[model samples]
Target: MENIFFPKVVQAVAGENRTVYAYMNDGSIRLVDMKPMIKQGGIFSQLEKDTFFEERLTVLNDTVAWDLTGEHDPTQCIDIDPFTVAECPAVADPLEIVG
Candidate 1:
């Protein structure tokens, strides 16, 4: 989840014409546009599509051993659970928050 900021950043580099809606886990709101993040991959691929259907995401930032499993070092990951997250106030935050 990364506090919705990642999406905003991604959109800025991906789709300049698209609109951004930043929703905090606590229900706070923020708006942004996609005009600065596109060439680096936007909603088409780097977009965060967390909506229940997608789950079990991970964020690996440790450059040394990677994750506890000693596998690939994932920079970021968003566990999707739109329904439950939207419903449960305490479960809307990102799963793996290394930063």
Candidate 2:
């Protein structure tokens, strides 16, 4: 897919069922359902624990990131590509974006 722009993530909230609400620089909010990605295993497997998954999410480098703490290598941080995540169907309302 051709992405003309990569929206900078401004905020995010992780919700149950592996859903993530991403607020982007374009002023559009997208709900990213990660259950399918997590099922693929590998680094995403670390998020199997609901508490860790929900509480550890952060916005970094204009994208949703996880494992930013010292326990994990900074370079190993798991994040979605900003270009790929941009232009997702927007949520109807900002308040409805919450997990």
Per-residue alpha-carbon lDDT of model 1 for 1-99, expressed as tens digits? Answer: 465522211110111244233353344333333223334453333333332112222222311111223343353332222332233222222333767
lDDT of 2: 0.77
Give the TM-scores of the predictions, in the order they appear: 0.24, 0.78
Task: Return the TM-score for candidate 1, rounded to 2 decimals.
Answer: 0.24
- Per-residue lDDT over 10-45 for candidate 2, one digit per residue giving the tens place of the 0 to 100 score: 888875588788888888888887888889999899
The candidate scoring highest on lDDT is: 2
Clashes found in each candidate (C-alpha, N, C closer than 3 A): 11, 0
